[model samples]
Target: MIQLDQVTVRFRIPHERIPTFQEYAIRWLQRRGVRYSNFNALNNLSFSVDQGETVGVIGPNGAGKSTLLKVIAQVIRPTQGRVRLRGRVAPLLELGAGFDYEMTGRENVFLNGAVLGFSRRDMARRLDRIVDFSGIGDFIDAPVRTYSSGMVARLGFAVATDVQPEVLIIDEVLAVGDAHFQQKSAARIRKFRQSGSTILVVSHNPASIKALCNRVLWLERGVIRLVGPVEQVMQQYAPDAPSPFSK
Candidate 1:
């Protein structure tokens, strides 16, 4: 379960861009302070997810969809308000987010597993399954920098979902791989759902959201526009358009 109360995330943006450190140094020497403006990524947002609930978040670009996930995942603390979470959380936010570019794919799995509070022995037992699911083949021994974007995403997903966490958070990383891998990833998520895990997913793909989510939360300009049943929110968010999930 997850709950957020009046959560607000604010960021400071400089009015003028300092292209280089040299320019910033010169401006500092001249005693001219850079002006900054505050932007709220999330504005007093409050919501809750029940255990075993599958929720989808959808919005246009810069609408705080990603920031909401980061806040729930504890990657970003809200500037105001409070958040509560229950059980272990497995967050697949950015592709290759916890990986080291210099480390081999095999090594990075254990590294990320450790970050998730797994011991080396625990990861070792799960290593083969993770590698097999990733389908990295012999390339598992190669540096992550040598891998393709799809490979990196696959490896990350494999590690995060191999264990049965109480909560699963997924961002746009599902759009990374080919059709087959997408199917595999979806199946794994369904398995988690069947096991009574809570899920929060963000996707621009209408079909994906329709298929996976029981409820949808619509965010607009750092605020909650609506939150309700999937079809209800979908129709309200796009009234005139044909349903993207319709055959």
Candidate 2:
């Protein structure tokens, strides 16, 4: 359902101090003073997820796990190579990604749904369920800026999982909720998996990855370190330990 071919995402980050716009402009005119270093967030990474596979992405910090997810979700374009997705993708990459802080939670739900390509009628039908699942209760009418981080996570998870997406891309945001809500969210995700959605999740928590994914993709420094069944890959990723899945 998802394919990435030689996907290389590069960023030209400033190597020297050119903090202000005026300094940058002056340096640009000089051409000699300005310097940039190429940082490859993803380097010729290629992977594919079949129609009903649950793939876990595990990596250390700065390993480009989140970048890989953003690429699959089309939040950012690859500097080189191609990505093909055959079905609808629900990306819970960032909680409250499309929300307007000034808008009420009720309004932001519709706004986020619209960003996800849902029609007004569609969001209207799912609105009550989303609110109920979120457990924001009376606070649903309050501006989103007033909501706590956990509250935002609940709302985002509820809305994103409300629809049965053909492909589900989840980042590590699921851990932001309380333990009770985390269990609730995991149960909901299990239901989605049972229905045959292709799922790609990025998590530092090994148990979460092991529990949810059949196959694991281990990335390090923007490259694929290993890809295989969860047990084998996790064994290599974390060696000779009792709690190999521990973060």
Task: State each candidate's clash count.
Answer: 0, 0
| Whole-model lDDT values for every prediction | 0.90, 0.90
TM-score of 1: 0.88
Per-residue lDDT for 55-98 in model 2, tens only?
A: 99998999999999999999899999999998899998877778
Candidate 1 local lDDT, 100-142, one digit each (tens): 9999999999998888879999999999999999899999999
Q: Candidate 2: what lDDT?
A: 0.90
Candidate 1 contains a number of clashing pairs equal to 0
